[model samples]
Target: MLLSLEGLEKRFGGVTAVSDLSMHVRRGSIHGLIGPNGAGKTTIINLLTGLYTADGGAITFDGTSLVGLAPPDIAALGIARTYQNVRLFKGMTALEQVVTGCWLRRGVSLWASFIGLAEARRAKKATEAHAMALLERVGMAGRAHELAETLSYGEQRRIELARALGSDPKLLLLDEPTAGMNASEASAIGHLIRELRGQGLTVLLVEHNMGLVTEFCDTCTVINFGRLLAEGDPHTCLSAPDVQEAYFGRRHDADRIQSLR
Candidate 1:
């Protein structure tokens, strides 16, 4: 396993966000986490990335415990993520925003950066080159010099993905990557995620876009009210009665439900 959650739990006062949840992400596979609103999918990402301290249980990545570590500490361990809500440096150019992610792995010291040391300058140039490649990979190369805030919502999301890729992560956690995208844009992102997996990166996806999940994810886990409801291949898990009741519940469009079957 590349990542494993063991008996994880989290609560907020009287609300339980996630309870006794445990799962494993196979190395180099694309895994999906799906559920209805308030199902604690994002909460699991938070706990795994060190954004929230687990109230119980342990998260192990590559055999190391990840309890109580800070977010940056987790990033440094080769775990990178993009948010459900796009998080880009609004005032920064697209290149600059991605360079921030690349900085995580650069060995340059802060003092050296301030002093414009030769090695630091070289590292910055190398990082920028790598960031440019990632942006190009995601079809955002033309906007590399544009301000991050100026792009369309879908473009900004792509920039966020480019930035996460800049970190050279062993495991990528994506939260609702296609949250507000139209079908065309969502399809593009779905293709991009498949490409990423083909390149040998392990991905854990938290998304409500069943079309994308079923089309791209190698396996999926479903949660309801913060508890594990089902886990298996997307085709089997999504059709399970417990998942259909908790997620679909006759609320989805007929076409959507029919597609699942």
Candidate 2:
């Protein structure tokens, strides 16, 4: 397993965001976390990335204990994620944003970065080359010099993916990576994610696109009301009685969620 969460739990005051959630992500595979709104999907991501501390249980990534670690520390442990909303430095070029991600691998000291040590200076140049390669990998090389703010929403999301890839993560978390994309754009993103898998990167996907989930994810864990509802092959999980009940009606409305298609 590249990632493991065992009996994890989180509470926001009186509201339980995630309760006793547990799952394992096989290395080099795409795992889907699917559910309706407020199912604690992103909360699990936050817990894995160390944005929020788990009240109980354990998170082990690549053989390292991740519970209670800081975000930067978790990131340095080779986990990278993109948000549901596009987040980029408006003033910085796409390449520059990715270069910042490369700093994780470069390991430049604060003093060296401030005083511009010879090694740090060398790393700056190397990072640019690495960043450009990442941009090329995501088919954004032509827009490398463009400000992230100037890009379209889908384009910006691609740049965000490139930025995440710059860190050379062993496991990647994508929160609704195609949230605002059209069908064509969503398909493109799906293809890009498959490309990453071909390159041996493990990915945890949280998207409502059922077509993509069934086709792209080898395994899925479904959640509803902060609890696990089903776990298995994507198609099987999606078809499970409890999962259907979670999304649709027990009275046979026949209004299947389009994402399931």
Candidate 3:
């Protein structure tokens, strides 16, 4: 496993968001983490990224414990994520937004940059080139100089993805990545994700789009009310009665599930 959570627990005041959840993500594979609304999917992403501390249990990445590490520390260990909602700097260009993501890895001191040192200039130029390449990878190179706030929602989503990739993560956690995209746009993003996996990146995707889940994920884990509900291939897991009930209702709302297909 590339990542594992054992007996994980989280709460907000008296409300339990996640409860005794245990799951594992295999290396270099696209794994789906899914459920209905408020299923604690985003909370798990927060916990993994060190935005929230785990109340109990353990989270291990590779062989190291992630407990108590700060967000930047966790990121330094090669874990990166895209937000559930698109997040981009208002005044920053698409290229600039992505450059910030790799700043920590630049190794050039602020003093050096401020002093206009030749070595710092070289590093800055190299970083910008690399950032441009990432923009190109996400099909946003032509818009590299455009302000992120001015782009379409789907375009902004692509920029956010490129920014996350700037960190060169070993594991990428995507939270509702295709939330506002049209079917065609979402399918394009799916193809990009598959390309990333082919290039040796691991992805843990939290999505409501069952079509993408069924088509792209090699395996999946379903949770309801923060507890594990089902686990296996997407088709089997989605067909389970309990999974259907959790997603729809006791009435089974089969039509709704079918519509996503």
Candidate 4:
């Protein structure tokens, strides 16, 4: 396993966001996490990324324990993630934004960076070249010079992905990568994610798009009301009675949910 969460739990005063959540992500595979709203999916991501501390649990990455670490520390360990809402610097050009992601890997000190040491300058150039390559990989090379805020929502999402990839992560956690995208744009991103897995990147995706989940994920884990409901192959878990009842009750159009499969 590349990533493992065992008996994870989180609570906020009286509300339990995630309880006894546990799962494993096989190395180099795309794993999906799905559930209805407020089902603690995002909470699980936060816990794994160190944005929030787990109340009780164990998170291990490549055999190293990850409990109580800071977000930057976790990120330094080759775990990278993108937010549900795009979090790019609005004023920064796409290239600059992506370059920022590689800053941690650069060895120059702050003073050296300001004075532009020979090594620092060389590192900056190399980082720029690497960022541009990542942009091309995600189909955003043409927009590298544009401000991040000016791009369409889908394009902005792609830029964020490029930034995350800038760190050369071993594991990537994506939250709603295609949340507001149109069907065509969503499909494009779905294809891009699958391709990333082909390149040996392990992906853990928290998404509401069942269509993309079924099409891309090798396996999935479903949760409802902060509890695990099902875990298995995407197609099998999607059709499980517990998942159907939790996600497609009488209040929803069952046919619409079924059509997604």
- lDDT values for all models: 0.91, 0.90, 0.93, 0.91
What is the C-alpha lDDT profile of model 1 across 146-202, one tens digit per residue? 999999999999999999998899999999999999989999998999899899899
Q: In TM-score terms, which candidate is top?
A: 3
Model 3 spans with C-alpha error above 4 angstroms = 251-261
By the TM-score metric, which is better: model 1 or model 2? 2
Across 1-261, the per-residue lDDT of candidate 3 in tens digits comes to 999999999999999999999999999999999999999999999999999999999999988899899999999988999998998988999999999988866888999999999989998998999999999999999999999999999999999999999889999999999998889999999999999999999999999999999999999999999999998899999999889888778744766766887
Give lDDT: candidate 4, residue 220. 89
lDDT of 2 by residue, 80-163 (tens): 999989889869999999987787878689899789899988888888999999999999999999888998989899999999
Q: 1 or 4: which has the higher TM-score?
A: 4
Query: Which 10 consecutive positions of candidate 1 have the poorest summed lDDT?
Result: 246-255
Query: Against the true structure, what is every candidate's RMSD?
Result: 2.5, 2.0, 1.8, 2.1
Worst 10 residues of 4 by lDDT: 250-259
Error (Å) of candidate 2 at residue 210 is 1.0
TM-score (C-alpha) between model 1 and the true structure: 0.94
Query: What lDDT does model 2 reach?
Result: 0.90
Arranged by lDDT, best first: 3, 4, 1, 2
Give residue 96's error in model 1 in angstroms.
0.9
Which ten residues in a row are the worst by lDDT in model 3?
250-259
lDDT of 3: 0.93
Query: Per-prediction TM-score, please?
Result: 0.94, 0.95, 0.96, 0.95
Question: How close to the true structure is residue 102 of candidate 2, measured as C-alpha lDDT?
Answer: 84
